[model samples]
Target: MTDDSIYHVDGDLVPASEATVSVDDRGFRYGDAAFETMRAYGGTIFAWGDHLERLERTCEALSLAHGLDASDLRTRIDETLAANDLADASIRLSITRGVQPGKLTPQPEVDPTVVVYANPLPRGGLEGESVWDGPATVETVETRRVPDEALPAAAKTHNYLNGTLARAELEGDADEALMCDREGRLAEGATSNLWFVRDGEVHTPTTDGPVLPGITRRIVLELALEAGVPVREGRYEPADVLAADEAFLTNRTWELRPIATIDGHEIGGGPITARLSRLYDERVEHACYR
Candidate 1:
C-alpha cells in the first residue's frame, strides 16, 4: 500500500498491505460479515448517522455483535481520513463474525473483526462535479436475486454472490445489470437501488424484501416529498421499468446515476432524474459541509 493508504483492522491502524485476517475468520470462511459503503466530503462523512444506523441494524440481523459502536467507528473514520490527507473519499466499513474453526455457525461470543478504509473519489477540484460524467447503460441480467425467504435482502452481508453472478452476466454488454426477484419483478441493480419516473411521478420497488434499503434511496424519497414530487413504492415488473419515462439509480458512492438505456431501449428525457440528482447533491452539501 501507498503511504497515504491505511486501513483499520479491529482496533489497530495499519497500512492496507499489512492488514490481514485469520484463515479461520468467519467472514473469510463463510461470508459472515456486514458492511457499509459511505462517502465523505470536506472530511465529513455524508449521511453518516443513517449509515451507522443501518450498519448496526444489519449486524444485529446477522447475529454479529461487533463491539465497535457508531461513535468509535466515526472517530476511526476521521483518523483514517486525516492519515490519508483526503478531503473527499469513499469509505467502506465492514465487520465480520470473527474466527471460528470449520463450523457452519459462529459462536455467540466470538470477537468480530472491524475494518475501515477510504479511497479518494474523483472530485478534480470541483466539489459538485458528477461522479459519472453522463448516464449509465443497464441490462437485465439472467441471474435473479435471492428471495427474501432464502436470505434477508435487507442485511448488507458479505454474501454477495448473487450480485457478483448478476454482474458477471453483464461482462461485455452494459454498464450495469438489473436483477429480478424470484417472482420476475424488478428488484434492484447489482449494487444500486433502481428507480424510474413516469407520468410526472417517481416509482421504485418497495423495501419489503429483495432490495437493500439504500441510504441514498431513502434520502431521494425524502427530497422528492419535500419538493412535492409524487412518489410511489411497490412491486414493479420489467414492463413497468421499460415503459417508464425516465430511470435512475442510487447508491452511497455515486449518489444518483441516470439511466440512458435499458436492454437497448432508451429512457425518456431525465427531467425528474436531473431534479432529484441536484436535490441529492444539495442534501449532501448541506449535511456534510455546512
Candidate 2:
C-alpha cells in the first residue's frame, strides 16, 4: 500500500505521509500515550466497544484527557475507512498527552491529540494469513515483563520497550517471545496473552496482575466457560508451560495462534486448543459478520 491512504489527526483528515506530529509531542518524546489496535471486517470494527472501554480506562489511569467516546470514535473510524476505500483493514487509534510548550509538564488546558488510521489486512485475516496457518515456535527470552509496581500491564500505553526488547531476542528464528515476570513466573508473550493446555484443561494467567486483559482473551475464557472446557488461572512457571500438552497466544489482530514448541521443546497435541479455537472463530464470525 502507498502512503496515499488518508488518516485522521486531531480534527483534520490528511494523507498518511502528510500527517505531522510535533517533535515535542509527549507521545514522541516520552511515550506518554495510549493506543488501541482494532480489526475491521467488511467496514465494521469488531469488538469496538471492548477496545474503547479499555482505552478509556487507560486514559483515566494516565491522567490523559480523552476527547472522544465510543460513538465519536466509531464515526471517525468510518470516515477514515471510507476515505481509504478500505473494507477489510487493521485499525489503530492513538491518544497522546499533546504538545507541551517549553518543558516536560503538561498544561491542564492542552488538548490531547487523537489519530486514527487503517491499513489493509493481510491475505486471510486481519493482520496476515491466519495465525493458524501453521504452528508457531517461541523462545523464552531473558527480558522480563515490567512489574505492576513500575507499570501496570493493563494500561495499553506507548511505553512498550519491554516487549520490544524481548521480541528482539528472537532474531527471526523463533515465531514469538514468551516473557516471564520479575519473580520468574510466566507472564505473557511479547504482543499477546498466553494460554496452555494440559490433560484436556486450559490454563492462563489471571488478569488481576501482570497481563493486559486482552479483549480476545476475555472472549476465549467466556467461550471456554460456555463449552464446559475446564479452565484454570494463576501464577505458573516456565516449567509448567513447557510441560503442557499445547500452548497458544491471543490478540486483537490474531484471534488465536497455537504454539508448536517453546525454546525448541516440542509441545504435545492440541486437543483442548482445537476446541476453543473453533469456538473463538465462530464467535468472531458472528460478531463481525452478522
Candidate 3:
C-alpha cells in the first residue's frame, strides 16, 4: 500500500488514511459484518460470481440487508482498483450493519456501511510467482474450531477471535496454525483450508463441519476431478495428515501453498501438488489473462 492509496467507504472514494467508521458502528463494536478477500489478475477479479454468491450468503446469514445489488458493489471494487492504479492486487470488501443503538438486539431498519480496499501483489498466472516465500511451516494447536452449532461456520463474519487465538498459540514457531473440530477431527488453517495426498488420493476435511468453504478450495476440487485425480472429503485426524505423502493449504492469497512441515514432520509438495498448482495457474490465466 502507498501513502496515497485510495479506499471506498460507504459510497465515496477517500484516502486510505482518512477512511474511518463511526465508533458506535456495530461492525466495530460487535463484529457485525461480512467481508470477502479476493484477488484481481490483469485487472479482472477472479471467480467474481462465486465470491459475490458467498458474500450474499453471509449477509443473508447475518440478516443484515444492505440494499446494494451486485453491480453496485462491483463498481465500487473496480473504482477502488482503478483509483489505486493496481491491476494484480489483493482486494478486501466489507459490509457492516451500520451504526445502530447500543444493544444486543438489532432494529429492523438497516443502514449498511461498505468499504473496499486493495494492496498491490505480484502478478498471478502461469508466469507468476507465489506471494509466499516458499512452502509454509504449520503447527497443530490445541485451539479447536468453533462448532457450527455454536456459531454458523458458513457465515464469513467479522468475528475472527477463534482464528486469532489459534494463531496466537503458534507463538511464531510456525507460519500457520492448524485447528481441529470439537471431536478432534482436523478442521483447517487459521485462514486457509487444508489438503493432503495419500496413496494417490487427495483428501480434505468436509465443509459440513466447522471448515469455511473457501473459494480456492472449491476450485481446486473441481480442477482435481477434471484432471482425473481421486478426491475425498471426510473427517481426518492429525496423524492422517502427518502420514500423508504430501500436504498443502489453500486460500485466495496463498493459492496452493505446500506445507513444508506440520508438527515438525516433513510433508512437502509432491508431483500431485505440482500438477495442481500448474492447473490452478492455468485456470487463472484462462479466467483473467486470456
Indicate which candidate wins on TM-score. 3
Q: Estimate each model's TM-score.
A: 0.95, 0.93, 0.98
Off by over 4 Å in 2: 1-3, 122-133
Off by over 4 Å in 1: 1-4, 123-127, 171-173
Off by over 4 Å in 3: none
TM-score of 1: 0.95
Going through the candidates in the order shown, the clash numbers are 0, 0, 0
Q: Which of the numbered candidates is closest to the native, going by highest lDDT?
A: 3
lDDT of 1 by residue, 1-290 (tens): 25648888887889888889998888888899999898878777887888888888888888887777678888888888887888888989888988877889678886888888999885422257777767888999889999988888888989999989998888564778999988899999999999999999999999896998998899999999999999999999899999999999888876888898999899944889988877887777777677
Whole-model alpha-carbon lDDT for candidate 1: 0.85
Can you rank all candidates by lDDT, best first? 3, 1, 2
Q: Give a tens-digit lDDT track for model 3, residues 22-77.
A: 99999999999999999999999999999999999999988988999999999999
Who is ahead in lDDT, 2 or 3?
A: 3
For model 2, what is the error of residue 162's alpha carbon versus the real structure, in angstroms, after optimal superposition? 1.0
- CA lDDT of each prediction against the hidden true structure: 0.85, 0.84, 0.95
